[model samples]
Target chain A: AQRVTQPEKLLSVFKGAPVELKCNYSYSGSPELFWYVQYSRQRLQLLLRHISRESIKGFTADLNKGETSFHLKKPFAQEEDSAMYYCALSFTYGSQGNLIFGKGTKLSVKP
Target chain B: DAMVIQNPRYQVTQFGKPVTLSCSQTLNHNVMYWYQQKSSQAPKLLFHYYDKDFNNEADTPDNFQSRRPNTSFCFLDIRSPGLGDAAMYLCATSSHRESYEQYFGPGTRLTVT
Candidate 1:
């Protein structure tokens, strides 16, 4: 069974505070991990991917194969950063077109 | 420019009534997908079309069906929507196969009355 898990349904942080959204996965084989964000009244879009190892909009996600975790992190949070973030895992095979997404975490950055 | 477009941003349908949601893409992608997302829940894959070949999820109910008449358009038909069928139907497109990056459309919120 392949599944993605985001432990926190909501995370609130003060402006300029550090923010971390945890995500974990369970899969027998190697998987591709992704983080997607959706703003209010906006469509969901890709924020970053584990393979790229790059930061997007001051956000970065590290993939730990040993722990099966791909947690998204940002050193300083901003009010505009508040949105619904989803962690997804892609199966390397067997209907590769589909991505298994977690329930998602809603982040709120207050001033 | 919107790569994907879903019409009728909000839809209301009576219980046991059939409803159709339409989606069109301008990216000329070969693969299109339909997902059902409820409030505070993850989006569940209903089905997808890869160049006219429809692939249905094992757990998808028969009430939910999809059609891709061409590469640019797709439709999701709910034969008889139930109360639980109310959700946000999302349409997504990818340029190629097995790609992690997907462009999503403004979802259609379906309300079952």
Candidate 2:
């Protein structure tokens, strides 16, 4: 079965500290991965995709095929960064398929 | 800014009552999707419409149904909502030409009494 796993339910960090949100996947075929975020009082939006390989809002995620991981990282955290993050695995390798989402991790940045 | 919109951000309905959630998108994307998210759980795909073609998830309950009247709007109808049916219903849209990024609405929080 194809699935996405977010090992941590919550990750708390102080301002200016580095943070990492781990995401792992189990899939028999090539996988298209994504990181989505929901900020307080805001809609859930796409944070980044493995295909893009670009950073957004000081955050970056690298897809490691061997380890089956697409961990999101930020060198320095800010209070405004607190939000719920979900890692998703797409059914199709082409990026258009049912998105299988992980339970999600809540990141809290303390000032 | 053109975006996906969900009506009645918060809805309260009685048990076994029929309720409908509305979603509209101004982006004119080729695909629109509905997801059900229970408390502290990941959002699950309920169904989707890709340019009038409807696709339902294998495990989605029959009590739930959806309709896309046109390119810009979609509706999720719960025929007989039970207590367990309460959840945050999210609406999202994506363009076929655009790389897999989805634009989401604020979502509707449905409460069953």
Candidate 3:
């Protein structure tokens, strides 16, 4: 079956510390991957996508095909960075845009 | 600015009562989706409408139904509310051909009592 997995339920870190949130997927065909974040009392929003190969808010995610991983990384974490992060995968069907998401990881950046 | 919108940011429903959640988008995207998310869990896809075509996920329960009567609006209907169905109902929209970044609406938090 096609699935995304974020192993850590919660990751707490001090401000200015480096942080990494791991995400792995299981799929047979090529799939588009995305990292979404939800801040408290805010809507879930797109953080970044693997295809873009770009960084947002000092965060970057590298898609490692050999290991089937697309872990989100930030060299220095900030208190405002605390939020719920979800890893999602989308595949091209005949004409539908279906996304399968993993149980998210909650990151708490302490001051 | 173009964005997705969900009405009634919070909803309260009695057990066995029916509730409807509405969403609208001005992005002119061809695909719209509804997802159910509980505390600390992944957002589960309930269904989506690609243009005028409706697609439902296999595991989605029959009690959860959706309607996209037009290009700009979609509705999620819960036939009979149960305590377990209380969750954040998220509505998202993206381009038709590709599942690019989906623009999400401020979700509606449904509370069942």
Candidate 4:
């Protein structure tokens, strides 16, 4: 079975505080992972993928094959960063059309 | 400019009513997908179209069907919507040329009475 799990349903933090949203997956084969964000009154969009390994909006995620984790982290939380974050996994590495998303985490950054 | 578009952002339909939701993408991607998201739940894949080929998820109900008459347009039709069928329907697109990115549209929220 292929599944993605986000442990936190909501993460509340003060502005300028460090934020970490955890994501884990269970799959037998190699997989591609991604982090997607949806802001208030906006559509869901790709934030970053494990393959790129680049920072977006001061956020970063790393895929650890050993632990089957692809946790998203940011040094500081901003008020604008309050939104719903989803962790997704492409079941097959080569056939990348389909995605399996986790139950998202809602981050609330207080001022 | 909006790359992927879904019309009638909010729709209300009566029980057992047939409804259709439309999606269009200007990115000219070769693949398009439809997903159903219940409150606080992950978006579940309903089906997709790679060019003209349609692929439906194994557990997707037969009441839900999709059509893609052209590369840029796709439609999801619910033959008879039940109360449980009300959800946020999202449409996404990807290209074989680019393996990692998927463009999403502002989803349509369906309300069943």
Between prediction 1 and prediction 3, which has the larger DockQ? 3
Q: Please, what are the lDDT tens digits per residue for candidate 4 over residues B13-105? A: 999999999999999999999999999999999999988989999999999999999999999999999999999999999987888378899
Computed on C-alphas against the true complex, the DockQ of each candidate is 0.62, 0.75, 0.65, 0.74
- Summarize candidate 1's per-residue lDDT along A54-109 as a digit string, tens digits: 99999999999999999999999999999999999888543444788999999999
Off by over 4 Å in 1: A93-96, B97-100
lDDT of 1 at B62: 99
lDDT of 3 by residue, B1-113 (tens): 89999998999999999999999999999999999999878999999998898999898999999999999999999999999999999999988544556889999999999
lDDT string for model 1 (B1-113, tens) is 74899998999999999999999998888889999999989999899887888999999999999988899999999999999999999999985643537789999999999
Q: What's model 1's lDDT at B88?
A: 98
**If the candidates were sorted by their lDDT against the true structure, best first, what order would they fall in?**
4, 2, 1, 3
Would you list the clashing residue pairs of candidate 1?
none
The lDDT values for all models are 0.92, 0.94, 0.92, 0.94
Ranking by DockQ: 2, 4, 3, 1
TM-score of the second chain, each candidate in turn, equals: 0.95, 0.98, 0.96, 0.97
- What lDDT is reached at residue B58 by model 3? 94
Worst 10 residues of 1 chain A by lDDT: A90-99
- The clash tally of candidate 4 reads 0
Cα lDDT of model 4 by residue, A1-111, tens digit:
999999999999999999999999999998999999999999999999998989999999989999999999999999999999999999857674599999999999999
TM-score of chain B taken alone, candidate 1: 0.95
Compose the digit string of candidate 2's lDDT tens values, residues A6-90: 9999999999999999999999888899999999999999999988989999999998999999999999999999999999999
Write down the RMSD of candidate 1 (Cα, Å): 1.5
